[model samples]
Target: MELSILIVDDDKLLVDKLEETVQWEKIGISMVFTAYNIRQAQKLLEEFPIQFLLCDIDMPQGSGLELLEWIRDNQMEVECVFLSSYANFAYAQKALRLSAREYLLKPISNQDLEAVLSRIIEETREKRERRSAEEQNLGQQRKGKTEFWEDFFRNPSEQERMLAQVLEEGFYQETDVLILEVIKIFADDKDINYKKDLSLFNFVIRNITTEFFENNEQVMEAVAQVSDYEWVLVFRNLGEEERFLEASGDLKKHLNKILPQRSCMYIGETRPLKETAVGWKQIEIMEKKILPGTDGILCERDISEQDQMLSGNAAYRLPPWEIWQKTLHNSEDLDGVCRNICDFLKETFAKGVLTIENLERFLRELEQLVYCYLGEQQMSFSQLFDSREFDRRERDSFHSLDAAVGFVEWIFGTIKGRGNSRRSQEDVVSQVKDYIEGHLNEELSRGILAKMVYLSEDYVSKLFKNTTGMSLPGYIANRRMEKAKDYLEHSSLPVSRIAMEVGYSNFSYFSKTFRDFTGMTPNEYRNHMTKNSSDKK
Candidate 1:
């Protein structure tokens, strides 16, 4: 692959000299760009696919360390080398922390520069080639295994033939007991389009799983992608179920740390090769019955326990729809009604009778009750609540018991407002703003804010926008940036601390966001502001 490099320095002469003197092409750098400031360097990096960065540690506008921080924050894959006039240990330490390839003092010889550049280029090329080969091998293995399992599952009559094929492949023996595990990945962030990146995530997850089992005593026979977000792993001779469970717990923790998404593992029964299909079918059924929001490792025993609990309470029945409707119609206290609904749902869920089908039926009944109440008040549902909000609530209600209870509370809260005087839009927006200002250090999700005001997230966002002439996220970001600036200008707190004070957990992400907002890194901004303050004084 052809490589490119960018040289950044405040001294234009130094940058020009390097560009003219270095035999970049001989050092595997086919293209070279020179920038005299951090801003210009940032622009060049964004515009060109630069592979290497050689920057001076001290600059007038922004230091090379700050620029490197920005690059790392943006996840740019660039090998960096730092040039410094003074041999400052602190500067070298920070540079190394940011993954700089080398920290060389000023007046370095051309031979040394070429040697460093040549080494970085060779290392980068080898790393890329190794990754490419691994991905290719993983792709081939996945394709073959997926095809085999698809056919094996499809042609039940040819099971004996498939068994023979598996034996020939040495994946399993007739006497070996095999275990099947189904892993499902769930995206916690609503903004992440997981489906669009499932292929890449699948490859990563597969690699992690393979590496995990390689260290264990059990042999992983095969891995197959069963669906868009699901994979099935076949393990042979998985001795001692307790040991397997212990290892699975560790694996789940590792996956949670490394993967960008959450995963749940469902362990199937260990059966002989001839009964592998039956084991897969049983595990699939058990996985479907798992309650929403349930994660981590689940096994057949959990499902079996749930089934027993349900069978033990076979006579349990929910309250009649008429009774619930009557209670809703007569209740003058909205909070009381909400509390009653939540209590009932919680009790039912605890009893193991709140299946997905049961939850759907309950929601349908609640909807009818709501419509009847709205009609009696001479108000339409859409007039009282946005249709989009209602749809979102309904869709989210199926995800978890907490979501279902929240939906119910929102529904009743809206109904109560129809009978009473409603708060003005300005008042609601002001209330939300005050809360946000007071809680800048805490998580401020739309859902949490919506719950605080008994409004839907969509409704709250629209209301905030209508009142402030800015989107909800835009307002939050502005407030955060303003606060961050105040801290940087007046206080001596570290940038990472300021980031936490403004509700950001990841320091790198905070740096990126701050740069995008202010056009300078935190340190640069602090320096510039301090200099201006000194001049004014």
Candidate 2:
């Protein structure tokens, strides 16, 4: 993190100019030391912990190559850049042989110096991170819960010592870093349940990956559980890039079998041992990019390509979420709801700027809205459909705009099936009327009718009034009186017994109520009905 650079040139004025004009400190090189001769350069090298060496090839006393030889002999951790007035082949050959980072012919332009310094700084910084990663493997404690991750990213200088030592061990020389995000959906389950499952699942996947690499002698790996849902695996490719990919794909298959469609894996780009941080950064970026309707082994190349980005509704805007909610909330035809969702998803994919973050956020909020809407219908999503299954679809199911839209449609389709078990007030009001007429001998109240149709008492009253243009009690009483007249004319039963059958306990009250309903006494109406019947015969 705190790197120092040494500029050794026989030209004093050139050394001073190079030191003053170029800001070495900006590139993680905290200290810049200059020397006029090889003796002075060697003394500075011995005295300081310099990681980068910028030395003149043609120094007085001894050549820059000789000074480099001493550095190699001492096994010092220094990257070198050779400077000379001429592009001599012999000097260039010697510099290459000594593993110099860059060879700049003198009267070097500012652009050349800046380019060389920028490269060296990046190389040096990566060297530190690789060392830190190796130290993580050396029982020096890998970052717990990404605590060290934040610190390492925030300030590299704070972790220089162990990182430098880690690189010295030369652990991972050339490797590919794979970040596997185990995606799962648990319906009607708590966060505690998810946490428990994730822990067990992460362990199994880690074990599987380790065993996979161990079985192949061509590969070696270091696995870290960087977050609750993510695992970071750095493996030496050993010239088997395809093999690594195959193993990742196979691992995805295995995980899918165990966790169903809830599990997914993401793999980053393969990189050299020196650029470990680049692969890490790539993983961080690519993890946010899951292909729609995909569950496993999403490669960086798969999402980075424009073809993938343009695959789904990349041109149109979605109607507001509230519109979808209202449609699903009230629509009876399940097929219609699904079709509308499909059309909207197309538009959403095409019109909106889609990124993994915004897209996933949109899907999550939509799921919540669906849940709330279902609740208004008095339907429990957990009871009607597996929340666990849908939960996976909610999170792991998004990979493209088309896929996202399909997932939403599928969810609505399931809701329609459950909705079939429940009906509206308008549809069931006739059934309530039929029941009231058939049960005139018994007490028929709005509460009873509501229970028959699974609606509230107040709602049943309103529905009956709205449909029949009469109050529920008025309908019931009128039906009872009409039934009483039919019985009086058709049977020889006494008025009191007839009253009992028609749900009237008192004979006098029944007589009075019947008179009020039909504008005549029951006996009078019966006599009239008999006279009409005889005349028709």
User: Against the true structure, whose lDDT is highest?
Assistant: 1
Tens digit of per-residue lDDT, candidate 2, span 1-537: 577899988889999999998867666678899998888888988988888888888876889999998999989989999888878999999899989988888787876788878888897788889988896765344234234444433453554543344457653233433232323322223554766777676767567666766676533344555555555665554566677677667766676676633555556666554555555555555555434333434566555445444333343244476776676667645577568767755655454345565576667676687778778878655544444445656654554455576687777766665465466656677788789877877888766775566554666676689888999888888888888987898998988899988889889999999898888888888888889989999
lDDT of 1 at 451: 62
Model 1: lDDT of residue 466: 81
Candidate 1 on 417-470: residue-level lDDT in tens?
646645777878888999999999999988777766656577788879888999
Q: What would the TM-scores of all predictions be?
A: 0.49, 0.41
Report RMSD for candidate 2.
Answer: 30.4
Local error of candidate 2 at residue 165 (angstroms): 4.1
Q: How many residue pairs clash in all the candidates, one count each?
A: 0, 17
The RMSD of every model to the true structure, in order and in angstroms, is 15.7, 30.4
